[model samples]
Target: MHPCLEQADILELIFKEIYYRPTGSHTEKDLLALALTCQRFKEPALDTLWDTQLTFGPLIKTLGISDAEKESENDAFDRDVRVILTNDSYEPSPEALRRFSSYARRIRRISHVPDARSSILEEMNTELAVLVKLSSWVRSETPGPMFPNLQHLGFIGTLSWTSIPCLIILLESKITTFSMYWGNLDPKESEVLIGLLGRLGLSIEFLELTPLSYIRTPIDPNKPSIFSEMPFPITLSWIIPLLKELRSLSCGSISLNQLALQNLASRCTFYKLQSANTSDDLLEAISDPTADILSPFATLQHLELFEDNFRDFIKLVDYMQPLALQTLILHHTAPPTASTLADLLHSFSEGQHIASLRQFSIKHTVSEFETINSVNMDIVFDGLTLSPLLSFPNLLIVEIDTPCGFDLRDADIRAMAKAWPQLRRLQLGSKIGWGLPPSVTLVGISELLIHCPRLEDFVVPFGARTDPPPITNSTPIKKNMTYLYVGNGRAPGDGSEQMALARFLKHVFPDLCGVGGEWMYEYGLEEEQLDWAAVISLIKTQC
Candidate 1:
């Protein structure tokens, strides 16, 4: 290749890397600037700039089509074959309208018809008419052959359920991923849209619905109660039918009534279900009578049930009779009981022929302080029958987010070590409070590190109150421990506490890879001194 071309190629590659960085990375702005330095850089940079997903109002403003012309044709088309109009709200500006109109004229899909009378302004108006005409054309178009390569189509702002029917009629055959947020469609209307989706011949692999909120009271408190009480409509229940074809489905605050879930299970072989707020009513809806609610997930690989009713979780486990479940996630909630927790584990072992379960995460809600403090350390560590099951011998990760005060004994840790020989990651939450003895904190952690020999990552809140006895080298630690996270809290021995902890780590495990912690403001160490670099370096080594 010529040297000039090679130089251009290098610049293009650099530009692509910078453009793809996560939104807030420090290098993003600088990279964008470098890409605009010359013509070769300009083309790729502009391509990246236009690669953005476009919204409807912005398109209208960008194209500069007049409202009169838009009203006349009712069809809008774009020359960029890859471009898709997102129905998100965008306030249009005059310049945007002209740009879009100019781009629209080059596309073959928009046909121009001449009238006997010709005027420049009228010709511009006619061009606008063509754009609007395209929009209407899309509405009436049948589903057989439009947009064959389209992967995603998102609806942004409020749109009536009826409008969605048009969408279904147009692109249903080609689109595989669909997402909608905060639309005006009521539950009944939403159901209609879902039903329409079920009839589409194409397979939709992913579906996401934004949370819907209805106003119960007007802001004017003094106005005569204008809001007449109508029997609140039954919760919207439309998506059940379409669930059958979905590989993935996510919704906000879904009410899993029995019928809805049964419908979902019968029709859809869903591999994943993510929900924000799940009620017992909904849990009861989907649970199998004889198995854990999770049991029916024969094909399910990933499940995220965030901070739901604990009872529902129990019911879920009861229904989730052993299947091929691999990953289980429980966020912002405490385990209901040792028995319940055991049952969940047992279900995974007995119900499913799982070769290896990858992750088990439980993040306790902040309010569960007492529960965390009161956790029966023995049951969690030693009392439970986890060892005999030996079901998750290949388990890779376990995470628990809870308040401080719960204490784990050395024997309990040893039991876990015996059960999960190949465990790789463990994340636990710790809060410092007045009630617990300092010795209890240090010993529990020391015991855990000593037990899990293959463990690689350990995250715990740091800075527990200073007690007379500091963590010593009595217990042996696993040499492979590589990542450590210490949360912010009070630490003993001033700034030296961190160094002391590091010393303890080095002494107990000479192969110590990383050290980092959250120290209380009172500790007087600047935030910059938190040893994050050391921690990162350690993690890199382990990886």
Candidate 2:
């Protein structure tokens, strides 16, 4: 035997290098050949090959066929290629189980998402039944879990009473990360799913559950939907005790009510929480006269709430202070009232989150239910509306994407740039409004680059009407900036305006690569888009 083969670590490293290569590299065939070479190479080679299993088909085939099943001519190759399960009740003998255990123990990750493009799991229809029988046999013979070293498990399919047990069996204390996506289910099935996850306890750390919806009946415009995105209410309230060590959680459309928020804050040490729909439960709870003032989300660092109108957010800041909160993202479903917007912005200072907060994003767009004109007339974010955030020293990224007009002037842009010298990305609005002219101009952008040298990706709406200031010897050349989004800013189609603006950008933003804007054809502004494209071309050639 080679001396390198005697050292298990060195041999494993060589096998891993081959295994981690890109697909269609023939790493599997080569590893199988090395496993059949000698006893020394077999264990390490097989270990590398079985580290990650995309499907349970390979494990099911390890049980072998029954006596009633007839073997085909290409049965050996067929078995190697796909799972051939003739009998779900085929009991694997002690010797067969020993073979299965060798490979099963080597598995570290199993992600069996059904109907995944170009995956073996697409063929897994009735084959999961064999796993139930196999798990039972393994438990009876072996003292520990089947996949002892398995740390990550993901399943994206239907979860019934029978399949829930399969998942429960898979959930050992060693697993840390889990992801599951399932279609609509009844309340009972949801209970079973929650119960299954409850077993993980403190062992699990990262959890993401996306509840997919499927409609069986036709839509009726007259009546309201019983199934509003999420079919059944799946709360994380009961599972709070189990997920004490959870660091990140994403509950798609599954709301975390006020009590759940309190429990999570008091019990769990999670830092990140995201929900598609943040209901008014928190607001209602805090407003209750009988409710006691308790500290909520003490350890939370990142929070993203979708489909909210800042009413709950306003109440949250009023009730509790986010001592450790860093990132706050609010995607409003409805246009925020001027008072609500002012209150929400000013609450950051009251909460003492000015120093800790780094990234702040507030986004809202006009839907079919509302028009651009309504959004424009309702609220216009100006210097005063955004002035409260000027105290955040460590703020790196600020994105306020409203599809309406912004009333921010040149002074406001310069004030922001001067406030956060460490600013990297400053995105203002979507630039989709009409008839409302922009207040900030090209000179404001020049001043922004001068103050914030670290600013890279900048998106803002500014009037391209006035000519930019002439470049001088003392002008600060911002070489770090690469992309600038012109939003809904219209540019002059005249050659003189385009050349001068292009020249100014080239002198100030030396590293500027591309200039982008919103789709102009939707608003019949093809000439405006063409003018910006001309600026990009001039920046490259004029320099």
Candidate 3:
């Protein structure tokens, strides 16, 4: 006989690990198999199985609706739909309904993509698209929410209107996180959405909104920008006040109502906030120090800005004097010269922003970073070295990408290591384009292992001129390094100096596998899609 399996927590963890794999045929099959196993694995297995639901169609299918056959029929409405998502006139099998309830409540997150490929409400037709309203119309309905315990909700639909009712139905008290991407919606529909969010009140912690396109056509901006033409019909004031306690917010691709946003920024308490990458309006508002706008980001600990230009960055940070900010993320931007860098550091230090900030990140554009090009450190690097940054008591992470126009090199690297010796994860350079010539060489990078003994991840550019200074270290400098990526493109494409550089890394950072910079762009991948950590492992095994 099999030994009695009493470790329920261990069983749950095992199921969770299995479900972490890519969501495909294998994951579904494995989860189904575990659920069908002994009753001990039922709850945890099911919870893991339903953690990230791509569609609610499966739950409807569990009601025994022959979805395939129904789709084949020409009729827009499916007969089996009423059997489960019924109105006043219909009834469902108690056993089937109970089974549906069991799984629905188990779901903690749901991505209800009920489009043509996974249509549930579409089967009910447009009139019944608002399931809650339809249930009221019929005078009879299910006893519980469609997702009673669902804390996170993400909806993907062809049109903005398609997800509005779906969002409304699931915008219950239990849901704290909501993300949606839809195509279109009218002003009336937009109003309904704003009303629905009020229901969530203080319970909502994370809200992501993406509009497929602007509800109103934007006039040529040669003259003026006005709120009446704002893409979203709903005012930001109405939405932000509702989620006053929001800790994290991502307003995706939606140009917010400026007036409403101004009011919200002045009053709302956001710890971490990110705006879309489309425009500079929001960024402009954040740093605007006009008396009309009180910097509402008084409690913000993290602020992320996605910039496509270089000059705007100077403006964006110039006015952002935060009180509690710790982590700042700047993505996809051009590099700054040593003088410009000094000016920025001085601004933060003089403003007292660096006093509380522990992390400063300037994600530089590819190949354009320049540091060695400067003739004097006293003039260029002085402000950087002498600024408040060197004194940041709590500073732990200093990551800067290769500057867009600056030729970053050895001296710059050494200056950074000397300033922030407490850094544990020090990464510099990018995987793709930066116009400036590479300047960082082995001479400076070697100092990192010597100074920052706790450094765990070191990524730097082995530019065309980079070469390891003569070193015969018998052992690793600081064995704590967990990840390393050196831009080993300095040697000719025929692979001459790469071997020596590889050897240098192998000796210095014992855990390093190989250099990486070309593979990602060659295959066309975004930062999120590329798994550099896994690539490190693969390169290590190959080496």
Instruction: Report the candidate with higher lDDT, 2 versus 3.
Output: 2
Candidate 2 vs. truth: CA RMSD?
A: 9.0
* Model 3 lDDT per residue over 1-543, tens place: 001112345578767878776667366777777867747666676677666776554455455545444364323235445444555555546675676666667778876654463264553333225344433322233564666788887766533455455555567537788776522444455555655676554577887665322222321213222334334434334567567657677654334555545545675566766653322665656545662666656677776655555456556555555555788766553445556666656656665565577787766322223322211112222224335466565577876654233355666666667777777776554544233435665677777667776777766655533455666653336556645444423443223344455556556766754445544444543342234433344336544
**Candidate 1 deviant stretches above 4 angstroms:** 1-147, 153-173, 179-202, 209-236, 276-296, 306-320, 331-335, 338-348, 365-390, 409-425, 430-457, 461-490, 494-543
Per-residue lDDT tens digits of candidate 1, residues 1-543?
Answer: 212114446767767777787877647458656755665555454334333333333233343334323343222223211122323333334454444433322221211122223232232232233333345433343222333344565655444533553465344445566676634455455444545555562467776665323211111212222213322222324345543557776654353445555555554367766555343544555555642343345577767666545556656655655546567766544444556555655655665535746777666543312333333233332235334245566667866554433343435455666666677876654432212332234555665566666777766443333432354555665666554555443344344444554455555556656545433312554543345444333334432
Would you list the C-alpha lDDT of every candidate in the order shown? 0.47, 0.67, 0.54
TM-score of each: 0.50, 0.67, 0.60
Report the Cα RMSD per candidate: 14.0, 9.0, 10.7
lDDT by residue for model 2 (183-262), tens: 45555565557656765545788887763121122111123224344444434555755676777776655666566565
TM-score of candidate 2 against the unseen true structure: 0.67
In order of lDDT, best first, we have 2, 3, 1
Candidate 2 off by > 4 Å: 1-143, 150-170, 180-192, 200-202, 210-235, 241-244, 268-270, 276-280, 286-293, 306-312, 365-375, 431-435, 453-456, 468-484, 499-515, 536-543
Error of 2 at 114 (Å): 7.0
